[model samples]
Target: MSEQQGRQRVDVTLSINGKSYTRHVEPRRLLADFIRHDVGMKATHIGCEHGVCGVCTVRIDGRTARSCLHFAVALQGHEIETVEGLSADGRLERLQQAFHEEHALQCGFCTPAVLLTAEEFLAENPSPSDSDIRAALSNNLCRCTGYTNIVKAIARASGREGEAASSGTGDAS
Candidate 1:
């Protein structure tokens, strides 16, 4: 067996959702695996081990990505933010509220990733159009939600249908 493929001892610290976790892990342990197993953050789901589905998505240092695609060893000392980190005092964020009000989910499989990605997107854009939302989230695939309510939810979150239609065409501000 390869060195990193089997269980081996390694110590690291991870800042997740604004909390710190110092633990030992195996080299083969995936970031998603570690996030769920060690830190007990269950929101980061594994949809595709190959990184196609965005269900395993999380924000590592403010950029969203497939947690399954990254290794735990690579996350040392880096700030990780799972979908669970976005709330305050157990209440949902504004984007999440928008999602709920707009009925932006079904089956709830891809909801976490969608929400995280949407969170970062809206923070940067804060006002994106439908096409803009689609383009920003093109990599994420949702079998439920039909990408319609999700789109509308983002638009609603931004407070503008016109905002939802704006491309990443201009400078972000």
Candidate 2:
């Protein structure tokens, strides 16, 4: 534990996006806060504070977990992956590209979480069906697209579907 602003804090070392970060935080500090405020990465969005919304999702030790549900101290020595880490050469990754091509995002609040979740799902199931894609995305909430385009984007990323005929058009619900 360390002293910060006259308050007690615990030191946590987190490996995020292939980088290591050590910060003193309160025991109650959420992993999402640590990643965003302490580590200075903004790709992980905080939504619903509770675990009901997957907006705070990140890959912990290669598995998708809600950052809002875990304490910063609990993530010590664990690897975390945010949407910012998914790309190489600063260009959007294939999954992100698919989301763009399929017009999977609107308002853009839930894109990062959905992208992270889709990355994990594709890694585990490279050839998922449309139903499988829908099942995987069920945890993340997107008020804009009604999930049809999101499912199609995942399907395209997984090689289960072809390129979308058009872009930015809302899909059939």
Task: Give the whole-model CA lDDT for all candidates, comma-separated.
Answer: 0.78, 0.81
lDDT string for model 2 (1-173, tens) is 33564487778898998888989888889999999999889888898999987899898988889999999898887888888887745534778788888888889988988888888888898887666777787899888877878887888877767333344333332
Give lDDT tens digits, candidate 1, residues 1-173: 89565767788778888888878887768999999888887878887799987889998888998899898888877888887777744434667888888787888878889888887888889767677888877878787656777787788878765342343232211
TM-score against native, each model: 0.85, 0.85
What are the candidates' C-alpha RMSDs? 5.1, 4.0
Residue ranges of candidate 1 with Cα displaced over 4 Å: 2-5, 89-92, 161-173
Inter-residue clash pairs, candidate 2: none
